[model samples]
Target chain A: DVKVTQSSRYLVKRTGEKVFLECVQDMDHENMFWYRQDPGLGLRLIYFSYDVKMKEKGDIPEGYSVSREKKERFSLILESASTNQTSMYLCASSLSWGDLEQYFGPGTRLTVT
Target chain B: EDKVVQSPLSLVVHEGDTVTLNCSYEVTNFRSLLWYKQEKKAPTFLFMLTSSGIEKKSGRLSSILDKKELFSILNITATQTGDSAIYLCAVESAGAQKLVFGQGTRLTINP
Candidate 1:
């Protein structure tokens, strides 16, 4: 089974603070994605990386960025957190770009006050 | 714009009852349609349908897609309390690296 692990299960930060969320996959998948799950909106893609050091913006990428320094690790960074940024963040990894089955991490619940 | 829509935003039923969830999509260069079950955390993979007129089943849950209608249906028979979760439908389009997800159907099974 593919196991995706997020660095923090829950986090709280003040406004304007920078936040970092880390995700690691054990299967060494080549594709990684970051998304924010909000009420009634489901999961909206924030950013995705097809390979190390390569990143692409998704539907909702404002105030967020991503890094893929290694094949097994992907990171989501919030340049300036705000109250509106409080939501559940999910990380997923797949074998390739076209692989439809994306294994998701446990998710990080972020609270910005 | 590629869009995926799910009907009956929410539903509540007693255990052992049968339910059908609907998902419709309008996307270009269609690749596949996927179903996911989400509790309070990240969504879990359920089924993926790339071809129409074929049904995929697992235990009490089964799904079928229709390419002509551009829609899909997920049926859960003999529903259990554990089946209470948000059922999400996503569509993957060719040349697009991401999947377009529906708002989801929130199913609640009472015992």
Candidate 2:
């Protein structure tokens, strides 16, 4: 079975702090995605990488950046944390071209205060 | 802008009852529609429908899509408490490799 793992299951940060969320996949999938889930808003795409060193902005990429230095890993960076930035973050990976069904990692619930 | 919408934002019913969840979408160069079940944490894949009238089933859950109508429905029979969770609908469009998700429907099953 494919497994996607997130760096932190729960995190707490203060406003103005820099935050980093990491995701790793064992399947070596070529596509990875980052999304933030909020109440009543569902899951909104933040950013996605189709290959190593390649990144593209999703619908809601503001205040967020991504890095894909390696094929098996992807990172999400919050420039400066804010109370409104606190939410459940999910990481997913899938095979490129075909097999669009994404496999999700155990999400990280971040809290900013 | 591509958009997906789910109906009956919340539903509660007793065990063994049947329920149907609805999802509708408006996306240019439509690709496919997907359904996911999310509990407390991450959402899990349920079904991916690309063809119309072809129902996909897994035990008690079944889903079908209508390309002409641009809508889909997920039906769950013999509901269980374990089935209580948020059901999400998403759409994939051409040129957009990412999916557009709808505000999920919260379903609660009481035993």
Best-performing candidate as measured by DockQ: 2
Candidate 1 off by > 4 Å: none
Which lDDT tens digits does candidate 1 get at residues A1-113?
89999999999999999999999999979999998988788789999999999999999999999999999999999999999999999999999977979999999999999
| Candidate 1 chain B: 10-residue stretch with minimal lDDT | B36-45
Q: For each candidate, what is the lDDT?
A: 0.95, 0.95
Off by over 4 Å in 2: none
- Model 2 residue A41 CA deviation (Å) reads 0.6
Candidate 2 DockQ, CA atoms: 0.78
DockQ of each: 0.78, 0.78
| Tens-digit lDDT string for candidate 2 (B1-111) | 999999889999999999999999999999989999998877899999999999999999999999999999999999999999999999999778889999999999999
